[model samples]
Target: MLEQRGILVPEAVRGRITRRMDPHVMRDWFRRAFAAAAAGQVFGDE
Candidate 1:
């Protein structure tokens, strides 16, 4: 979703997301990504 919007997903952010263990949190991040302008926005303070 971020890619479709031309938002860049940095490696650090990718690593963080990839490192997540909770499926619920990951699912929330996926939903948030649909509306995020940047990859960081998907995780926020996480």
Candidate 2:
């Protein structure tokens, strides 16, 4: 879903997930972080 949504996942979360997950397992935590940042920016702009 992340790739489909054009999201950029972070390397930190990616590394931690890789330690406990299969190399192909993908979580969208970084996308959530990015969304948080974008939301903050939008509020700041207002």
Candidate 3:
């Protein structure tokens, strides 16, 4: 069963966050910003 395999553990495999508190999007933005900065593009200041 899934429980025996730990596949049904109480872990967050998917989530929905508020627009203002979307950590996944924020992380992606940070990644893109860092990449842009590294490539000498104009990313906004922190």
Candidate 4:
């Protein structure tokens, strides 16, 4: 959706995220996601 709205560039999403998101928040989010995956939690199944 954001890509279609031109808010995100597909090729530059990684760099953009790093530049736009707070580093601490991003790190925390990644940690949670990884932990969930490791614990065998299924994503987007609700």
Give lDDT for model 3: 0.36
lDDT digits (tens) for residues 1-46 of candidate 1: 6777899988887788778899999889888988887787887856
Residue pairs with backbone overlap in model 1: none
Q: After TM-score superposition, what is the CA distance of residue 32 in candidate 2 from its true location, in Å?
A: 9.6
lDDT for every model? Answer: 0.82, 0.41, 0.36, 0.41
Error of 4 at 44 (Å): 14
| lDDT pick, better of 1 and 2 | 1
lDDT: the better of candidates 1 and 3: 1
lDDT per residue as tens, model 2, 1-46: 3434555446654455456544322233434544553323212221
Tens digits of lDDT, candidate 3, 1-46: 2233333322331222123366766575446544352321212332
TM-score on alpha carbons, each prediction: 0.77, 0.34, 0.34, 0.33
The model with the greatest TM-score is 1
TM-score for candidate 4:
0.33
**C-alpha root-mean-square deviation, each candidate:** 1.4, 9.2, 13.4, 10.9
What candidate 1 gets wrong by more than 4 Å, as runs, is none
lDDT of 2 at 40: 31
* Candidate 4 regions with alpha-carbon error over 4 angstroms: 1-20, 37-46
- For model 2, the superposed segments whose C-alpha errors exceed 4 Å read 22-46
